[model samples]
Target: MGATTVLGLARRAAVGVAGAMGLTWVVRAAWGIPSAMGASVSAIAPVAVASARYRNRQFHNTEPSTQVAPGSAVSLLLSALTRQGVGRPLGAIPLATPEVPERAGALAVTWYGHASVLVEVDGYRILTDPVWSERVSPSPVVGPARLHPAPAPLSELPPVHAIVISHDHYDHLDRETVRELVRSQDAPFVVPIGIGAHLRKWRVPERRIVELDWGASYCLTGTGPGADDLVITCTEARHFSGRGLIRNTTLWASWVIAGPTRRVYFGGDTGYTTAFAAIGATSGPFDLTLLPIGAYDVHWPDVHMNPEEAVRAHADVCGGEPGYGLLVPIHWATFNLAFHGWSEPVQRLVTAAKAAGTTVAVPLPGQRIDVNALSPQVPWWEDVRRQ
Candidate 1:
């Protein structure tokens, strides 16, 4: 073939490849678009407007909060680019096969990593912030991918009494996980006020979508003896919510799970807030408290709780007593969402909790901890960090 003929064929081949790539991008974008944006403002407005916290068209925190600190945007961007390998474990993050019993125990918790937890209280099981997706983003191909695989498949989870969502953020309220749970479980999704619109968009049955404002409570009755009533309460948290560019159209909250004989607190994600003290006064002195101790940075001080703040929050929710409850750290190990060392949160948490006279359980991903039979603190993450 002549030089011109060969060049012409190469150009045509490049065009064909480019067209195929463009088509693939269109297909992926189309698949994620609906679930990613999640309910229009009109659909969410009717419900959100009625709440006391809803004013001027979006939800607001009791105390003012800045999602990102003033003048920190440039520094945050710089940090994001420069910080390398600090957020990941040096070796494989250990996983455990959750030992779930046929009947839910009196009080136990299985940490599935990065805010996904299964809580068992008085024979009823409640799952919190269950994100089973590989990437906590609208697009599957991009965003903060999981550092480690989910300890167990969604199908492996036993029948839960309820699935509770703290906020509408991609990390906590996942679209794919919700769809899977809707198919596999019959439990209702107990969420904060405006999140029902998102669930509705995802085709979650109306009967199974329970939306509550701060201080609102939902009582669930389970089958069998000692399972008479489990009350799930939406309490306060210092955080913001948004799945897309539009922010706080939905509400964020901590949850109070109170069984007849046992009580647990699931702090989905939050900065330290004074409201925790009020929550403790009304419905706490809890047996266990699962609080976020990760994805925290100085730039966003009013949002995610650092390890020290988490310890204080634990005490505030446990009736103003430092050593009142068993604190288990979440929102750290599975996803590298912040710039801290992989094991730094837990290490700082352990030190802070010790100083506060607080007892804490650092469970491996998917490891079950029975509140009654508490175990000694094992520095498991130290080994992982050193590796």
Candidate 2:
């Protein structure tokens, strides 16, 4: 073979190798970006900046709050390193097969763990902060994975009248789950301010997205016999939000779901705050209150609620008395998100509720209980705690 012919072949081989390398790099970069990390702050800021929470180019809690206090990283790091089984149950978390009644008259709550719940109020179903994905993270291969299987598949869920999203946190708002629901369900999504951007990014239809600022309410049209329809109000919560490094471009909220006969409150992830009393007075007197009872620590004091705080918030929302409504504890027993013992939240909550003369339901994942049947509380976590 001639030397020039050999050189030509070598040049072609080098070009092919370079082309393949370029293609691989491109694929890696694109694959790293997931819909789990939704819209950027800048992309959604115009809508967010209109709210009272939005100021100085970021959203703020009603009161001055610190999400993570200075120099607390040391304790957090030590806890994360030394804690062995603090974050998960000793035994497998129990599951309940939900038999949703054809129609709920007063109210009923079906808890799906980690802040996901289905509230059947006056014959309409409202789903809250549903996380059906395997893990709550931007990466498919990493992040916090579920400790137990979902009580039931999303496809098995009953027809919902509306889906309420409290915030944009990955654990509450999942990418794959949201995409699947958009394709399968006809229910519109009622979300806090600026969360619609994320839904839009996932190709959810504009007509089906209802975004409300704090203190605003949207009435579900054609869902009631009378003029009074199912009204969902965006209420205050002392928390922050972010899908990426930057935080609080979108508002976080607790919610009020008011049916003709039954009223419910969904306390999304939040720190202890006084907004509960105002919520109670303004749009509450809830028949059932669903609140977070885990993933709380002194380090991040102004975000997640402890069990005691959750009980307090529930009373404050339902009226000054815990007897006003049934309290269903959520945001635990599904993922290992904090340094507390797996059963600690339920244990503490039961004690608190009893002291306050409040009725509490500690349902296992997928347990559906009628709010009016709140007596003889079940200690489902005790088996797991012993195991």
Candidate 3:
């Protein structure tokens, strides 16, 4: 072969290799690192089938149909992918606390962004819906990435007595975070009924886990010699759950943590429903309520509450009076799971809470609120979104 012909063939080969390399990167980033489908498979493939079977039964019991239409769902999916109309990026807000304060009977809450909260009450520290993963989706590369970094690393957290999971969604029941929590702390895993299956699959020992159905209560009686038995009850929430493709195989819930002196409620996630009033009537007038306030859209109004509905839920949980104890909002500022402006949730909640005479404390991401002090005043999120 001529020398010129050999050089031309070499150039063509190089171009082909470059093209292949570029394509591979895109594919990897789109799909996540592969996993053993066997674990999530048993629970995954059956979802669409289960959903179809339960469609009629679910609709008959649920509120007037407001489910998102197929076309709308497609539109939303495209918008999220393109990030079109996404507003200015909101930087992480700083939280300054000289030291973590000691609260005996008082409840302390540390917001770890979006549904993850560390509640210290009655000398026992309990963590809830802990999601420290980089993304909320099953894949690490695509889907809704975290809007702000975690307030503190999971390893740096104070010793927890228990880790409670509300359900088995990717955002709420992160496999990675669960493994980390299991390794870092010796806390028992308290979860709703079917969620134990997920934890067990992840290699958590059955001895260190407690599974509860709705209305079931688990008491943490003295683990050692000098421990108090605090009661955590699984309360009903109007929400659905699924990690991969399936939905609602496992139950979702809110928790009522009661002690001898103080009682607090953690509303994991829910839509606008009359059940809140029932909860308040039955086990409330609570000292504090950590409720979700973001990732809401009109498509799934019955599944997630907007800012206005959250205020109402607050009042219902506190007996129609917003002036009760303290209100610290969660489920916002962490993950970009929805299309609304990053700061939209807090902005709307502030106005509604103020008009209703509710006493609210919007703490920085990592800051801890005494629930008694309610210190570090002023709306910091306001400055962030306005920019």
Candidate 4:
């Protein structure tokens, strides 16, 4: 091509790139800015600030957890730049169409990918971290998108007794999902301290919102609805929270869901912490445990747990016998959030579970695992990604 033609082509390419970037910025501004930003700090802070975990206007983990260390940005950048197939699956991931019966079994869990789950504990249904939107970000157009489609639509889900939110991070607390749930379902949203402000900003009714600081509990009753008097307690998680520039303005937590007969422990997202055993002693010996087993890195060990850590946490939650509770891993296989091989999380989890004598159910996204009749540990993820 002639020099003039080449120069013209380059100029057009540059302009196109610039235009794309500008459009992205505009979309983020219009859609990414959370409606909850201006939520009442008083509504969120009073209880949290009073807790021992609260200090300096932020929440802290019982066991000092760190998000990132000094001079780690260079390593993160390097990892991102050099990362090759680490963030994606080699083959298509299989999804399952979960069957939600009219009444949930004694104790069951439907893994909807990542941290989202539908727990059926002693006939009550609790949906945890339901992120049905395409992306888990402030802007639908600009965040970590789902790797696989949700097996079923939100409307398809059966009536849940309650919706439990762990924190205010974009991934765990999605605005659109919450809005739709408000319109469709009558169940109350149970969240950590201060997260109620975000829900209020999103127009969730005050009656349908229940906020609690760590160690607080809500008893639901009626003998016919809302878990028939199931108890949910906000428990400590070793992590930080933020939906925007302000970090720890809200609280992050794990949860203890106790029914009359069975109990479930949800380890939302956390680094390995010393409080696990304490949680077990206070409110555990759970029949089922949903824990994070993905998005772990050597540098940020204090934020997300590895598979091995998850197993250890499971045993702690089970009060010693790791094999006592049914384990279903979460926070992995749904999005490309970290620099690890797509299947590495489960692989490590299976190995660790076996070593720890913990029984784990590796259900495909949307697949439900009845904690009692637990299926054999089939390496389903391996079927897709051949070595």
Candidate 4, residues 1-387, lDDT tens digits: the string is: 999999999999999999999998797656746473435555668667767777888887777667886679989889978884487887889998898887888988898988999998888889999989888777657778888998898998888889999988878988889989998899999998888888878889989999888899988773754535789999989999887777888889999999989999999988888889999998889888899999899779899999999999999988996479788899999888889999999998988888888888889999988877866767889977784
lDDT of 1 by residue, 164-240 (tens): 99999999999899999999999999999999999999999999999999989999976665448889999999999
User: Looking at model 3, which ten-residue stretch has the lowest summed lDDT?
Assistant: 52-61
Clashes of each: 0, 0, 0, 2
What lDDT score belongs to each candidate, Candidate 1 first? 0.91, 0.85, 0.75, 0.86
Q: Pick by lDDT: which candidate is best?
A: 1
Higher-scoring candidate on TM-score, 2 or 3: 2
Which residue segments of model 2 deviate by more than 4 Å?
1-32, 223-228
Give lDDT for model 4.
Answer: 0.86
Measured with C-alpha atoms, the lDDT of residue 115 in candidate 3 is 83
lDDT of 4 at 350: 89
Provide the TM-score for each candidate, comma-separated: 0.96, 0.90, 0.86, 0.91
Q: What TM-score does prediction 2 earn?
A: 0.90
Ranking by TM-score: 1, 4, 2, 3
- Candidate closer to the true structure by lDDT (higher is better), 2 or 3: 2
Q: Model 2 RMSD to the real structure?
A: 5.3
Runs off by more than 4 Å, candidate 4: 1-25, 36-43, 225-228
Query: Which has the higher TM-score value, candidate number 1 or candidate number 4?
Result: 1
